[model samples]
Target: MSKVEDAVAADAATLGAMQINAFDANQPEPLFVEPYAVTGWATFIQRAASSRSGPQARVGVIRDDSGNVIVQGSRHSLTCLLHIARDNDAAADLYGPWQESWGAPPPDMSKDRLDAFFGEMKAQHKAVMGNVPHICTFIFPKSRGGGGWLTAPMTDLEIIMTHSTARGRGYGMALLQWSNEMADGFGLPLYLDAGEDVVGLYTRVGYVRQPDELRTSKSLVPMVRAAVKV
Candidate 1:
């Protein structure tokens, strides 16, 4: 089929599938996902903010009685990443400063040049429906790691976050419990990589660290929550 035909088919497939994956207290018009996979509720703030035009990933969210977003989480498919990857400026804005904060300098590449690079990769990496479950979560070696490589999870629980005002009210636990249930229903393990400071929180939620998992410069350690029979 032609590229336009392929895009139309893909979007149609995503629509029906999106309903089954909805994860939120109140849907976000289309769908709602919790903001981020937050641990250590004590450290409720994400120091760095990444700018992006919009997210192409699946998201879940929790809200207070007043209709405010209290918690959030998300999972990105390969197709989602491909779009963001094509939108290099958005990707850079979203992650560039986060990389810089880790003592790694930002790339010197021009915006056009960077887009061309990812455009090449987008052309090369064609994702089938089956690959959606295992999406890219973290890029190894980091931008500062001097290697530009991405590592995907078998099933990713990408980002979970809770607002400071909403912490200690059981929102974090609730969101995580929901995540567990969702994974169990899918019969796929939920995977994530965490930093040393917040590892305890995940451990409490049944995330077990693999011995082979190592921390990169960003200090991410791999952990997984096996699918449970619901």
Candidate 2:
């Protein structure tokens, strides 16, 4: 069985190609333009693997015996001390210095719409998690009279993908289980944005919809899994 390991910069190229194959190539409406996708993902992985500090991001890969990456995943966590702005400038406020890494927007993707989507996501998060230790939560703090603050930090699962040929071998679930185990080690809740088609899968794994969630035109669903005691 393939086991998860830290993805090094050398794995960036394969991860990039796999990203396009898993997310863009098969989609009816491609999220990334084909011409720029590979380099874009490569650059992203390279930078993340290099700094190892930015956003505390980490990438993992499961490789076949032949040493080809068959599945990839990335995750990060926000510490309790960081403060996120809740206003329209939230994204800019939190990520302005790192904007250069954002690169150019694809021609098929609308810059304004994308920005608006992120802006709305921030808004929803702020409403439900004002000054919380993390962006994700297990309960509605406001409804519970906790004044919109989660009890602790949460781990965010940013991306997970398995190569097409590797599907149905339980690779995706293995990666997800690895993520859950990691979060459980830290006793932090797990959060992710799930595509519409995979909502059932996430649900089966203990993730529940966020309160007052924001659904994208693409049917993205926001979910949070409560932390399991180690």
Candidate 2 backbone collisions, by pair: none
List per-candidate RMSD values in Å: 16.1, 9.7
Model 2, position 220, has a per-residue lDDT of: 42
lDDT of 1: 0.34
Tens digit per residue, CA lDDT, model 1, 118-182: 33322222221122332213222112212222222223433443322233445444545555555
Model 2's TM-score against the true structure: 0.64
- Candidate 1 has its poorest 10 consecutive residues by lDDT at 1-10
What C-alpha lDDT do the candidate models reach, one value each?
Answer: 0.34, 0.48
Task: Report backbone clashes per prediction.
Answer: 20, 0
lDDT of 1 at 66: 42
Best by TM-score: 2
Candidate 2 global lDDT: 0.48
